[model samples]
Target: MIPLTEEQQMLQAMVRRMAREKLKPRAAEIDNTGEFPWDIVELFRENGLFGIHFPEEYGGSGGGVVDLCLAVEEVAQGCSDAAVILAGQALGSKLILLSGSEEQKRKYLPRIASGEFIPAFALTEPGAGSDNVSMQSRAVRDGDYYVINGRKIFITHADVADIFTLFAKTDPEKKARGISAFIINKGTPGLGIGKIEKKMAHKGNHACEVILEDVRVPRENLVGAEGEGFMEAMKILTTSRPVTAARAVGLAQVALDEAVAYAKTRVQFGQPIAKFQGIQFMLADMAIKVEAARQLVYNAAFLADRDYKSKEAQRASSMAKCFATDTAMQVTCDAVQVFGGYGYMREYPVERLMREAKVTQIVEGTNQVQRVVIARALLED
Candidate 1:
């Protein structure tokens, strides 16, 4: 096991307690009903869980990326969707912390920190998924504002975000280099929410389409320079990937816990299934994978917290995200097997966990893309 500081240990204990007491009971209900858990979000806000990773000068808790990962892991142990609400808060504000001008930080970070606002990252469009360069969103500069026109699909929290860190091409001739980031407020003219996706898992969270039509944004709202959005987005992803891995680790650990508990009480062959060597072996492997994935998640968070720029850090983050999420999928499926017929039923939490695990492999860039990133980084080294 990786050693944690006293503060981290304390944070973990507090969050774990909160997860068990507050989040665990609601997780299955949230999944079954497919309702947004506003009360849970309010609880996070009331407890100062929103902006743990931002600087204190901007109304944050003054913690780093690792702090966010730690908190996320604990919350995810109960509800992956609840954990995502916290993750989305970080995702929205990270670009501001990384590359926003001082004015932007002063204007926006405080609201996010105070949980008075929810932010969304708007980059993916109808034509762009992994190939961000294929994005068709356009932003033409006027005298004092840029008129943005296009739509962003699969945007997290699109229906309720108070602000958006949006990407659009200001100069399309330069391809990726021409992309610029902007802070678009929620009520801007011609900006509206479109379809809400009915997803298979993480039902408490919604990903939707953000439609922007001749949306006028002041030039002062731009984040970084006019041509740095691509690099800024890359930086955000590298750090976010570790947190994503932390989510997977927490979910995997929960699956293992459920499997072990079921195995001990479940009768098979006239005795407890856990007494059998085969069942014991499966549980053992699940435990091993969970621990290994946890270690990698923490290691990646460490590199990210220190702002390490080495190729090793890049590779570690991708490795953790890929390995942990893949483990989540495998471990959850194995957990379902341990429950046998009961596992396949919706009454049991394992079935819900299994469905939730599949999304981790696809989100924060697919596991396939993560491997490509690791390989490219290795080649660079």
Candidate 2:
């Protein structure tokens, strides 16, 4: 078990209680109705979950990535959808924290930290998924302003976000090197919302298309310099992967808990199914996987908070994300198996868990992409 500081332990206890008492009861309704949980958002805001990882100077609690991961993991135990809402805040504001000008940070980070404004990261496009360099979005410099034109698909919180950390190519010929990141406000001219995707999981956290047609943005809103957006993105993603891994760990842990509870009471052939060696072995394996993944995730978060730019931190983040998410998929699937036919039904929670676990492997970066990153990091001098 990873040791936690007194403050960390307190934070964990508080968030765990909130998740069990508040979020879990509403999780099913949010999933079934596909409604954004504004009440939950308010709860997070009121409890300071939104600002847990930001600096105190920016209206936050001055915690680190580890704190953020702990909150995400605990919340995910009750509702993965609500956990996304918490993590999404960090994901959207990270670029500004990392690369925004002092003024930009002062203007935006406070609102984000206070949970008064929502921010969305706009990068994925119709043609750009894994190979984001192939993105067709373009921004042209126009005398103190840049006119951005593009469509970003699968953007989380796009419908309600007030600020966007958007990426586009300033020099299409330069490909990846040409990409630039900008801060675009929601009401900018020609900024529009397209289709809201009906997803298989994370129903309460909406991902939609952001349509930018000649959206004019001030030059001061540029994050970092032109051609540095992709590099900035890669850096922030490395820092954020550990949090994503934590989400997977939470989901896997909860699935195991549900399975174990069901197994002890489930009778078969004159004995509890948990008494059967088959079920016993499965439960043991699930527990082992959850513990292993949790350790890996915590280690990565520790490394991130220490020195995110280090190669060791980068590699560990990828490893944690890849391993924990795969563990989630496997553990959740086994949990469903433990329930047998009942697990397959919507009436049971394992089915929902299984669905939630699949996306963790795909998001942040696919498991295949993580392997590539790990291999490249190893090959580097």
User: How well is each residue in 208-294 modelled by candidate 2, as lDDT tens digits?
Assistant: 999999999999999999999988898888779999999999999999999999999988899889999999999999999999999
Candidate 1 per-residue lDDT, tens place, 262-338, comes to: 99999978999999999899999999999999999889888887774556777888999999999999999999999
| Residue 377, model 1: Cα distance from true site in angstroms | 1.5
Per model, state how many residue pairs clash.
Answer: 0, 0
lDDT of 2 at 20: 99
> Candidate 1: what lDDT?
0.89
182 in model 1: Cα distance from truth in Å? 0.9
Worst 10 residues of 2 by lDDT: 230-239
> What's the residue-level lDDT of 173 in candidate 1?
93
Please estimate how well model 2 matches the true structure, expressed as its whole-model Cα lDDT: 0.93
Score residue 13 of candidate 1 by CA lDDT: 89
State, as a TM-score between 0 and 1, how close model 1 is to the true structure.
Answer: 0.98
lDDT of each candidate versus the true structure: 0.89, 0.93
Instruction: Quote the positional error of residue 178 for candidate 1 in Å.
Output: 1.1
User: Per-residue error at 332 for model 2, in Å?
Assistant: 0.7
Residue 119 CA displacement from its true place in model 1, Å: 0.5
